[model samples]
Target: MRKKIVAGNWKMNLSLEEAQSLHSEINDALETSEFNCEVYHFVPSIYLSTLLESDQKVNVGSQNGYPAKNGAFTGEVSMSQLSGIGTKAVLIGHSERRQLFNESDILLKEKVDAALEEDLKVFFCCGETLEERESGQYKQTVIKQLKNSLFHLPSKEFAKIVIAYEPIWAIGTGKTASPEQANEMHKSIREAIEHAYTQEIAQNTSILYGGSCKPSNATELLNQSDIDGGLIGGASLKSEDFLKIIATYN
Candidate 1:
């Protein structure tokens, strides 16, 4: 069976103290619960070590990392550096990185290669913008992202990667793809993976929905056949809301 996961992307938000307190609150709530899916906290780089220092229930990962092991690249953290500090995973090609920071697919592929080399699990995010969606080219756009950045990897290496589909228009806009729409895109993504690799590999890969996925809509979205879990945004910042989404998997 595929791995079920709900990862929280605390994208560039919260101060160090706020980060710690929020994580602690999540941990405290989960202490007595038995969740069916794996949980991950993808926080800002500045707070990674402080959160990882403790033996917590949920895994911690970086929101971004440089492709190089180490270099004079100021303002960038390397995959090796992250691994050395016990960081288990990293997010590659998030829409914000692509649009806001101007990270191209070529650069994202290098980051995927570097992260996998260091044995860091990669949450490779890909999505379509409002224009692409409205143009009926959303599938083409997203598949192109996978083909350019992630499909090059051999199945063995690619098997370790988790795919998150975040509709760019939905992110941070208080908009969400309807459950049917989200699942349709997810199914397209899985079909693309199947064509790239093998049927078995595609079946085993976990594809997550990331948008305005809050407690209210999580169950409906997650219950869709192709959506394995979620990459939560705003809901994750609140422990109660995040926990409720996790409970939906049960």
Candidate 2:
């Protein structure tokens, strides 16, 4: 089965104390609940070690890491560093990281290469802005982004990655894609993978919808044919909403 997964991207929002509290709450819920989907919680880099020290029932990953394994780069965490700290995954090419830090596709591809070399699973993100969508370029835009950064990997390496389709416009605007819209994009992504690798790979890969996902809309959104799960943003900060979303999928 394609493992249905929900990953919470805690984006620069929690302190060490807050991280511990939220992690505890989430782990408690996961431990007590009977759900089949994998739950991965990603936190800011600074708290990775602190998050790992706890006995976590759910998976924990870093939000980002430097492309290099190790170097003279001061102030940047490398994939090796992440592995040493027990982080099993990393988010590559998140829209915020692309826009705010000017991370080009080339740069992100480098990050993906480095992370995979260290055997870290990747949550690779791709989507279009409102303008691109309005201009009818969203489909091609997303495909091109995938090709540039991800299609280069061999099927084995690609199999270890999760694709997150987060419509940039809907991400924090409280707007969401109708189920049809989300499924449409997800189908396109799956087709792209099929074109790059094989039909089996496309069918088995998990594609997550990540724009403003909440419990109220998650069911309808996830009910679509191709969307495997969610990459939750704000709702993930609250254990109740996040667990509710999982229960819906359950």
Candidate 3:
């Protein structure tokens, strides 16, 4: 079956103590959750050890990582190191990384390759900017991103990936892609995967919608045929709202 996941991207927000407290809160909520899906906390790199050491019920991952193993890259964490630290997953090509860090499709492909090589699940994020959407190139833009960075993987390696379609226009802007809009892109993503791999791979792939997905709109977005779950952002920092979003699947 396709994976159903709600991954909270706690991007560079919480300190170690703060992350620990939030993780504890989520753990307590999960005790009564009964939601039939996977949950992941994509915590900041410094807090990964602290966060994972406290919680074992839900999954945990890093927000980003370097493609190399161990090297002199001053501020980078390697995929092997992340895996060794018990990180079950890692986010590759999040828009912030691509935008702020200036990560290219070539660089992202290297990151994806390293993550999979180390047996880590990759939450590969791909999306279009506001201008691209306004110019009606959203579909083509996203497809090209996937093809250049992820589609080159062997089908088997690709299976370890979960695609999160986060339209740059909506993320953190409080603007959301209407359910129809999100589903349309999700269908296109799945179709692109099918064209590159196989029907079974496309059918089993978990394509998440990551644009302003909060409790208010998660239910409607998830109810669409192609959207599996969310790569939640700000709302995830709030314990109550995070639980509410996860509970939508139940």
Candidate 4:
């Protein structure tokens, strides 16, 4: 069976001290609970070392990374730097990055290649804008993004990758895709994988929902056959709510 994964994306939030405190709370909660699902926390670069030292089951990850291994790129974190600090995964091509930094598919693909080359897992994100979704171009947009950003990689190299579908309209908007809606998009993305690789690879790959996922709706969302788990945003910051979401798998 594909393992369920709940990844907390603490995007552009929390200071070093606050991150340490939050990590303490999360670790304590995980220890007391019976949650067996794979858990990851994508914190800002500064807290990676501190987060890695925790004795919790939560894997360490970064919100972003530079496409180059190392260079004179000021303010850019490289894959080598991330791996050296014990990061297990990196978030790539998030909607906010696309909007704020104007990252292109080519840049994202390079980042994916760089991360995989350094043996770091990747949570590659893709989604459509509100206008595209309303115009019924959601599937097309997702397919194109997948094709451009990831499909070029060899199947063997694909094993370290996780795809997150975060509908732009729903992200941080307090709007969520219904379970059926989430399942439909997830199934379609899986089918796209099947077409690109094989059914076995498609079934084995973990696909997550990432749009305003919270305790109130996490169980319903995760219950869908194709919906493996979540890429939690705001809800992940709170220890109690995050643990409640993790309990949905238990």
Ranking by lDDT: 1, 2, 3, 4
TM-score of each candidate?
0.99, 0.98, 0.98, 0.98
Q: How many pairs of residues collide in each model? A: 0, 0, 0, 0
Model 4 per-residue lDDT tens digits across residues 15-112: 88888888888888788778869998999888888789867778889999997877799999999899988888999999999988999999999999
Model 3 alpha-carbon miss at residue 236, Å: 0.3
What tens digits encode model 1's per-residue C-alpha lDDT throughout 1-250? 9988999999989999899999998887778888899899999998998999997988999999999877789999999999999999999999999998999999999999999999999999999999999999999999999999999999999999999999999999999999999999999999999999999999999999999999999999999999999999999999899999999977
lDDT of each: 0.95, 0.93, 0.92, 0.92
lDDT of 2 by residue, 42-136 (tens): 99988888888878787999999998777899999999999888899999999999999999999999999999999999999999999999999
Off by over 4 Å in 1: none
RMSD of candidate 4 to true structure, Å: 0.9
List, residue by residue over 1-250, the lDDT tens digit for candidate 3: 8978999999979777788888999888888658878999999899888777864667999999899898799989999999998999999999999999899999999999999999999999999999999999999999999999998899889999999999999989999999999999999999999999999999999999998899888899988999999999999999989999999888
Error of 4 at 159 (Å): 1.4
For model 4, state the Cα shift of residue 32 in Å: 2.5
Candidate with maximal lDDT: 1
Candidate 3 wrong stretches, greater than 4 Å? none
